[model samples]
Target: MKDDKLFTAYIKSAEHHFSGWDFSYITDTGRMQSELLPWSYGSMAATLVQNCDAFLDMGTGGGEFLSKLRPFPEVAWATEAYPPNVPIAAKRLEPLGVKVAQVEDDTTLPFDDNQFDVIINRHESYSPKEVRRIIKDGSIFLTQQVGGTDCIQINEALGVPANDEFAHWNLHFAAEELLQNGFKITYSNESYPAQRFYDIGALIYYLKAIPWQLEDFSVEKSLEKLYEIHTQIQSNGYFDVRQDRFVIKAEAI
Candidate 1:
């Protein structure tokens, strides 16, 4: 389950979602509802990141998670591949003392090795080797991934076998990669919580933002399912439509 196709498609869709908003003027005031977003890795970092001096934030989108680490860590630097998101992240984080970098080339990082005591990857599009190269020995690396079941759970109702059954991102994949690269897997866990879409239109908009659901989707038909879900939401106020996620902690050996 390489998930190459899903990644390719999803990146484009995510770009579209980010495109609609101007990051510089983001509404700075949504009280955090629960845990991180659909694919956040904060729950992983929370357990092991205490009292670190320097940190590297990989794939920092909108600077949401990077900003949270400010109080516990003295310095936090972030790298984002999406140029549109970089300035937005910088605008939000720099005000609070976090440094930001725009990663132009995919293969290399601008930092020196052994520079970060803690490294965070919420949803990385790059290779783990690149992540390994950026951190020093004894540093901690934490990631929160869209659970392996995320796609399957969504597509099962549609009677489509998950495109890459084995490809869903999860903590185990990261742990194995880290272990092979000389890191010790320390902790991992899953949180089950649903993010609701009030209407089928909203659900479609949400689906449009992620990959995999782009091709072969019948928007009108999916909207029917959305209406049913919305009806349930109207009665219950929330739906159990959640994406599973795995939080992981590993230490560079």
Candidate 2:
């Protein structure tokens, strides 16, 4: 494609509204794709939900993934820190009998002590102390986190400075933190999977959707680098990057 066409695509992607953790637009358009992890977080969460009496889902973005795991426990609750996702989560989860709470931040949990038998968190920030306080003794805490090195190649490709905010967010560190917080780590695993983007538009959309990836990212600001990547994609069919992910299952002792 020509430079003008590439510029148009980047502009369109930058202007697109990205709400609710959904990435269907890029995937459906065949612009970006990622390989699935070996293990199924959804399956594990479903099994834990089935065995627990009360459950809480942390950072349930629009309740999209949580809603898929049907037949929740008797008392089901979800917390969302993002303001726009609160109502969306409620609308989707209320019918399933799950109460969605809008939380101010990740430091405090609103629920009472021993309120839940199981807590599932996916790519959400949580306070270890709050989790320990809210969950019953011997309760389970399952979390799938995006590791610190996730998609670092995006920054490298754009010639931008790397962000070290999550530099130590790995499975080992997370497990150690849980242990220090009086939890027994039952399971832990980490993976670096490959991701591919077919077009500059998709890359722009992804960066825009996940602003933290490149906090100051903008189409105009990164035009030259984006064009370079566009040329690379045209020659190689896609631009590749590695995604960091980790899973942890801990039990309150």
TM-score of 1: 0.70
Question: For residues 1-253, could you state the per-residue lDDT of candidate 1 as single tens digits?
Answer: 1244532332233333434223221122221122344444555565445567888778888787666654756667888877778888989888887888989774688988678888877756556676678788988888776665664545654445665644646666767777888788877777667554433334444555554643466555554454455556557754445566777778888
Off by over 4 Å in 2: 1-3
**lDDT, candidate 2, 1-253, per-residue tens:** 3547755765577566777878888887777998889778999999998787899999999998999898887899999989999999999999999999999867678899899999999999998988999999998999999999999999998998667899998999899989999899888888998999988888888888888888788887888888889889889999999999999999999
- CA lDDT of each candidate? 0.63, 0.89
Instruction: Please give the distance, in angstroms, between residue 14's alpha carbon in candidate 1 and its true position after superposition.
Output: 16
Best by TM-score: 2
Off-target runs (Cα >4 Å) in candidate 1 are: 1-50, 72-75, 104-107, 157-168, 191-198, 216-239
